[model samples]
Target: MEHSRIAVAGASGLIGAALVRSLAADGHEVVRLVRREPRTPDEVRWDPERKYVDPAGLAGCDAVVNLAGANVGSRRWTDAYKARIRDSRVLGTTALAEAVASLDRPPRVFVNGSAMGIYGETGDRAVDEDAPPGEGFLPELCVEWEGAAAPARAAGVRTVFTRTGLVVSREGGAWGRLFPLFKAGLGGRMGDGRQYWSFVSLHDEVAAIRHLIDTDGLSGPFNITAPHPLTNAEITAAMGRVLHRPTLFTVPAPVLRAVLGEMAGDVLGSQRVLPMRLLESGFTFAFPEIEEAIRAAK
Candidate 1:
């Protein structure tokens, strides 16, 4: 893509914030979809719940990326909070899909955010885009979340869903919380540390989205993960080595369940996903190893 105009939802988030900066630095015209009243010409007001977005703001954009959603690990998952997590993704996606569909000239591509959680509890299996979704709240929610973008797909727009992995970054997300703990020598593996954690650096995550936008003749779900997936224990060891801390502590699964409620299932579950489709499409990762990603995050 040659410095094309791009519209982004969820511009305030960790991935969204970095993606916006990366796109702007590369000279792409960036427009942010905000929940608040428009603060500038580049910001557009939108209400996902109300299914309203000023289509004029998105007109003639080369691509529209939707990353709007609630943070899964932000708090203990109460029933209401779980509903918010689901609504935040599905409703926001539906709203954006409908808005883009209504445009006379929709974006050439729609890159919507997804997660590896869709293939719930893959154990030690290294799955990719072709794997079927496993059973669980997260899996079912992911199916619905991706399906929410039907309006855009139905409108003949080239739509893609990025099944992103655990983004390793110090700014925010799950790894952000782990950085401080590891720096203070309090970090350790959760549960027995056997579960796999598919991860990608923040740089790679942003780069993959741009690749999806630029690459043509590609649609459907793509795993935005590193080629190699490591178990939690391995990641703990890497963190200890990178931060010069001891990885001697362990958090039992029972304690995690008691504290995180239903969300503990995700924390202890395994999904050894790989970026098979992404690599085949010619997207390269700058930090494919755990150590390199940890060092970059630091």
Candidate 2:
């Protein structure tokens, strides 16, 4: 694929930063959309809460990738925090979608970020992108979150909703917390440890986004998880194997709920997701197995 200029929201985030680096390394010009004042030539300012972005600033980008949102598990999911989670996603996505649509020369594609929680708990059932949404606040949130991108899709941009799985990275996300705990022999399975955790290496996550940007005839939702989904016990074992730590401890579901509150359900929930669409589109994962992903994160 030929290199093209791209506008990226949440460019400072874990996946976003990696993408910016990857795109730059591949010789693509990246314009970062920041909330603060722009300090560089490649930065643009936007206020998602107000649905504001300078159309002229994003006028000629080849693609717009919206990865901005409050981290769902960043805090206790209190009533106000829950509102923050929903609003952050809907507002940011809507702002970007409208901005992209309003541009005289809109980008060819819009890669909108979403989550696999859209499937809720799949409990031993292997699910793909075609699976109907499951029940939960997350499923509903993801639906509306993805829906906020309608403007871009309506403007004829090939919009792709990326339903990401547990990202295995030391930088942050699920692995950030897990790595330290496992290094100190403190890592263990949550609940009964049977809940399947569909995951992808951070490397693959960024690569998959880049793939979507250039791949033609690909629109709508694509699952961005490893082909093999590991249960919580399997993940714990993999971590112990990679870190050479003991994996004898197990945290009860009740304990998790008491500590993490509503967020515990997500930790203990099963989401055996598969990147069926991405594989069908000829994209290959660099780390598709638990051990491979864990070792790579090491």
Candidate 3:
């Protein structure tokens, strides 16, 4: 791949940090947009909450990846919390777009972050990039988030919205949180465990991002998930198998609803998403199956 200067917003987050490391390793010049002053010169300070970004620093970049957003699952969706969640994404994306729009030499591509929640609960139906979005707060937020990048697209920049799935990694992410419980033989399915868990390994997540950055033909919403999605029960079983633990403890739906409220719906919702666009674009998946992804993460 040809080396290019890249700017990554939200460079402190899980995906952003990983992408920065990967890009740097791949010989690409990476400039991280941060909320605070970086201890090093490679970082650029930007305050999205304050609506200020260094537009001058953003110029001359080949690509810009926006991964800024509030953690949706970090708190209950009180009306205020929900508003914050929505605003964070939209505001951050809009800031990036505006900054790029003002740049003398704007990036050629803008890869923005989104989530599989954009598709809502697809149940058993396999969804793809071409699939219409579904209903729910998350789906709605994703739609607005993606829409916030319109200025960049209108500026002739090829924009790519990555609707990511459950990112499984041993270091941090959903798998890290579940590892201890499952390892202690107390891991179990949430609700009936039949809901499909669309997932991808962290390795594949970063790989797919790099692929999209390099592949100019790729644009629009691309589902960044493994080809072979599994149900909650299957995921529980697989984790148990990997850890040599029993997979008998099942968290009842009523309990989950009582504890998580609207968030519980996300845990129980079914979304059997497919990466049709990535596949058609000839982007090969490093870990297509759950077992392979799990073993690699393990």
Candidate 4:
């Protein structure tokens, strides 16, 4: 892909950091929109609560990717924290979208980050980008989260909701916590181990986002996951195999709920998501299997 000027919000996040490195490696000029005051040449300032962004800093950018949001699993789901989670995504996305839309030479595309939890519990049934949003908090939050980007779409900027899945990376995310436990042979399935997890390697996640940035014809929701979806038990086995450990233990559903509180529902919920749109667009995954993704994360 030819080098282009791209602005990225949430540049300090796990996925955002990876994307910045990827883009820079590819010779793209990346302007990181930070929450704090800009201290560097490539850093721009934005405040989500105030919905402020300096339009001059974003002018002439080819594309903008919004990944700003509170970490859902960062704390116990207190009502206040939950509100913070919702507000972070909605307000942050709205801020970025409105800013991008207002630019005199607005970005051609807005790659907004979303999640696979939008599908809720699907059991073994496979779903695609066209699948309707499911019930519960995550699905509801995702709906509002994606909706916050409407201004960009309405302004004629192609908006793509990158509905990402469980990204395998030891640096951060769900796997960050798992790596230590798994390495110590404490890794095990949470609940009956039947819940399907739609996962992708961190490498693939970054690559897919870059793909969307370069692909002009792609827009709207695109599921960013591997072709193979694995159940919790399968994932446990893959981790054990990759790390040369054992996966003979399991966490009961009730205990998981008691420990994780309401967030446990997502931990146990099954979502068999597919990348139908991504496949049709001719995008390829570097690690499409659970084992490969687990190994690659190391």
Candidate 5:
């Protein structure tokens, strides 16, 4: 792949930091957009809330990737926090999209961050990129989030939505919180453990993003998840087996709802997601199975 200048919003995030590193290491020039004043030569200032991005920062870039959003799993889903979650994604995406559209010489592609939550509760059915979004708060939020990139798409930029799944890693995110609990033998399945979790290793997650950036003739939504998804119970077993710990506990559905509030529905929901488009595009995963992903995180 040719080394290209790439501008990335949310470069401090878990995936963004990794991507910036991966790109820089591979000789790609990366311009990081920060909310604060730019400290480094490659850094630029942008206030997504106010819908402002330094167009000069994006000039002459091959691609623009936006991963800015308030983390859904970071806290309890109170009404205010829920609004923050929605606004952060929608507003930021709109800001970036508009900026990309305004550029006289636009980038070749725009890869906007998204999530598998758009599919809502898929239960036991296997769904792919072509499936219509499911109902409820998360799915609705995802729709608004992805739709915020309309300006870029309308401007003829090859926009791609990375409908990512649960990224497996030890640094941060949902799986990060589990490593400690499982090691202490306090880890167990949530609810009835029947809900499926579509997961991809952090390595694969960053790889898929780079793949989307580098590959030609790829646009629209791509499920950035491992092909094989496992039930919650199966995941629990894998955790225990990998850590040599006992999985003897379960967090009931009622308790989850009580603690997480509106967020619990997503915790217990099933999404047997398949990365059909990504697979068809010939992207191979470094960690395709739960055990393999877990070990990589370790």
Candidate 6:
């Protein structure tokens, strides 16, 4: 793959940070676009809320990856919180798309961040990139998020929406929260324990993004999840096994609802997503199984 100048928004966040490191290690010149005034040479200041970006700073970049968004699980989905979630993704994406589209030498590819929640809760049925989006807040948000990138696509830039699953990592994400509980032998399934927990290792998530950047033939939504997905019960068991702990507790649906409100659906909803397009593209997964991924992260 040719090393190209890449600009990444949301560079301080989990996935964004990982991508910055990966891009740098791959020998690409990475410029980080941040909200605050950049104090370093590698960073560029841009405020998505204000819809302002220095186009000169974005010039000469061959690719751009937008990962800016409000943390969905950070707060209760009151009307205000819901609006923030929608606005954050839509506005942030639109800002980047407009900036890229206006560039005289615009980026050749735009790899935008999205989520598998776009497909809603799919129970045990496997959904891929081609699956029609289902229902609920997440699906609707993802639709608008992807739509915000339409300008770049319409301008002839190769756009890819990375529909990510539950990215398992020891440093952050759900795995970080679950590790302590499982280690204490209090971790268990929420609700029925039958809901599928579609997931990907942090390693595979980064690799697939890089793979997309290299494979020009790939565009549109690509499921950034492991080939093998597991149900909540299975995930609990695997984590228990990995931590050498017991998985005997169960959080009732009503109790979870009381605690998390609408966010509880995030814990209970099922999304059995698969990386059909990525696999068909000949991209190999470093950790395809839940147990193996858990052990590697541990």
List ranges where model 3 is wrong by over 4 Å: none
Give the alpha-carbon lDDT of every model: 0.93, 0.92, 0.88, 0.91, 0.94, 0.88
Give every collision pair in model 5: none
| Candidate 6 accuracy as TM-score | 0.97
Candidate 6 colliding pairs: none
> What TM-score does prediction 3 earn?
0.96
Worst 10 residues of 1 by lDDT: 44-53
After superposing candidate 6 on the true structure, give the runs of residues whose Cα lies further than 4 Å from its correct spot: none
Candidate 4 lDDT over 37-140, as tens digits, reads: 88998988898767788778899899999998899876678889899889888998898899888888888899999999899999999999989999989999
Residue by residue across 1-298, what tens digits does model 6's lDDT show? 7778999988887788898898899799999998888898878888876667777888999888988888887767888889888887888899898888999889879999999989998887988888899888999999999999998998889999999888888777778788888988999988999999888988888899889888887899999999888889999999988899989999999998898889999999988998999999999999999998998788
Candidate 6, residue 195: the lDDT equals 92
lDDT of 6 at 297: 86
- Would you estimate the TM-scores of all the predictions? 0.98, 0.98, 0.96, 0.98, 0.99, 0.97
Q: In model 3, how large is the Cα lDDT of residue 78?
A: 85
Which clashing pairs does model 3 show? none
* lDDT digits (tens) for residues 193-257 of candidate 1: 99999999999999999989998899999999989999999999999999999988899999999
Clashes of each: 0, 0, 0, 0, 0, 0
For residues 33-81, could you state the per-residue lDDT of candidate 2 as single tens digits?
A: 9888989989999988778887777988999999998888778899899
Query: What is the lDDT, from 0 to 100, of the residue 104 in candidate 2?
Result: 83
lDDT of 3 by residue, 128-187 (tens): 887888898999999999999998888888999999998887766678778778878899
- Residue 212's lDDT within candidate 3 is 92
- Model 6 residue 239 CA deviation (Å) reads 0.3
lDDT of 3: 0.88
Task: Estimate candidate 6's RMSD in Å.
Answer: 1.1
